[model samples]
Target: MSTVADNTTVTEAPVADLTNVLARGPRPKRPSAWSASVTFGWRAVLKIKHVPEQLFDVTAFPIIMVLLFTYLFGGALAGSPREYIQFLLPGIMVTSVVMITMYTGVGVNTDIEKGVFDRFRTLPVWRPAALVGAIFGDMLRYAIASLVILGIGLALGFRPAGGVLGVAAGIALLILFSFAFSWIWTMFGLLLRSEKSVMGVSMLVIFPLTFLSNVYVQPSTMPDVLEAFVQANPVTRLVTAVRTLMDGGWNTGEVLWVVVASAVLVAVFGTLTMRLYNRR
Candidate 1:
């Protein structure tokens, strides 16, 4: 009986150890670079799909504003509605892209508050770059919004003298500017505690930036103080560059300044957003 008991104990020891190892199972492999980016991009796109209202604001508001402004003030400002529509189209495009910054910040805040980013931290991707990729992926929506606005402008008789190439260049410039502005708002979204606060704070800044520029009329037409503000504003430089580009003229200085300003903004705000992401 003693011999039988010893043999049983000896055999069970190895079996028990095998069972323990099996319980733990194999470790999960880290995600690859392509997989991580695709995951992040798809998630971002899905979020946009779920919240159609976010896109509606950009699409619907610009159309309404263009109609209202072109009809109401067009005759008074440009001696005819068609001319006013042309003058206002570029400004509207600039404002439309700038307004997208609000959504950038709000979206970032929503993801953070919901702990979506926390989940991303566990993935094998470069976390900072993932956030940027996600934000940039949304630029597709901005581009679409811009196109819709341009189409409306065309319908309203706002012809671009720059032809197809100039129109394409104008659209490209606005999208690039929007991407640069996204970095700033993304930083704000990462730093702010809530979505509502992000929206409020971003709008508070964007409204003045949009209106104080030569968006509606020539800077010379504004009051002295407003004219000075318009002259000093970077948006004015951008507007001038865009106007020249679309009007089929060459203003190298304005274009150069706008490019430089955009570069500086992207560098500064992009750095800040990365730092904030790292800390988070």
Candidate 2:
């Protein structure tokens, strides 16, 4: 049907025409990858705001670990609790970052369970923005862990012979390692069925690397086989590098190894994570 009013002519289209027109309507422009990633990162950080308790593991765990090791085993391990703290802080910092990285997987798995990832997948932004943004948010957790451990250790008569710059460099390295390590958990988050499973598996991996390495004790004290594993363990390298840096030593060999290991980890796990994410 058609009607004429003033100088305008109006025509009624078929119902299907209106439906088809709407189907072809323009949508909002998609954001750039960086912008999208920042937006997503903000959202990921917001998760902590809503659930403040989620930060307990990062903030409190470092304190507990530092205090426990310093008080309980410090005397036996390093001749005195005070002396042991000097040797233990760097190792504990590395272990703290390693343990906290698992929470990244846990958070991602929780999002998967809640269909948040599905919603993200439907967005017009870059596909990897969700994971990247979450990683950015996770860096804050790493910072908190490192700072708390260092601060508490300082209060407990632990002094870094490397001074401020050394401590800063060591912390920077640890954070870099944590970022690289988180990719492994990111892949597991994408592949695993549940958060609990990821946590269990991650802890299993963490325990051996941390306990078997020169964290609480020197590798020289261990059996040959155990010492061999510790020598090759990346965690050992990281701990040694941090200790060297914080102790004012310029030995770049262990630090180089940590860098290489972190780079390799980022390359392998990052690729795997992206592949699994796309498949999902």
Candidate 3:
């Protein structure tokens, strides 16, 4: 206690209590949603840097597929390896990129298991920041995969009649569609218990959808029932759309159907993922 100039008594508050309050208030400002997303996206890129093996599927797998399919089945399927490659490149591009979306689920599940996900949940950033960042980061993988396929195809004498602009358009469309398709895997990541399980289930579902379509052979050659399934397959439609674009021709019907299908997938799976994320 001390005597004031006016003669009134004064008391000082405890210094330790005030220190704690001031320390709590001085925390760094929470980032905006976009900033948070970009920050997390950078983190994801760094993760890939640390684990370069994450790119094996996008790089090596495409090379193997292009070489294997063109050499092994080209004569039987098409007139020659060259002709088969011309048809096969676009289909393989779409199918391989789509197949890699399952890795998003596996990655997310691994984060959850590692407790990184729970820490993310406590952050003051947008709730979907991690998911969006992961998806955006995957665009790099998609581009790398596309480049690998195109580069190998070109080396193997597979030329695109679509010209550079058309090839560029096809690649852009595939990446856009892949981004939308990833939400379904993200939902699965949130719902599933393990990354291995997610990978297993994703492979189980994806293989049939891809193989049953016109990825490897002409649908016209299939049995009537198989042809119908091939015709209705969304992957087949996407491949057709890509083929048309790569051929420098417009196939509005196929492109529109693929866009509509992608929109529906994004809407459905995005909502489901968010719901599950919140619950978790």
* Model 1 weakest lDDT span, ten residues long: 129-138
lDDT of 2 at 62: 91
**lDDT on C-alpha atoms for all candidate structures:** 0.82, 0.89, 0.89
Pull out the clashing pairs in model 1: none
Worst 10 residues of 2 by lDDT: 1-10
Q: Predicted candidate 2: what Cα RMSD to the true structure?
A: 4.3
lDDT digits (tens) for residues 145-205 of candidate 2: 8999999999999899999999999999999999999998988888899999999999999
51-148 in candidate 3: lDDT tens per residue?
99988999999888889888999998888999899999999998899999899889898999999989999988998899888888888899999999
TM per candidate:
0.86, 0.89, 0.90
Off by over 4 Å in 2: 1-29
lDDT, residue 181, model 1:
80
Tell me the TM-score of model 2: 0.89
Off by over 4 Å in 3: 1-29
Per model, state how many residue pairs clash: 0, 0, 0
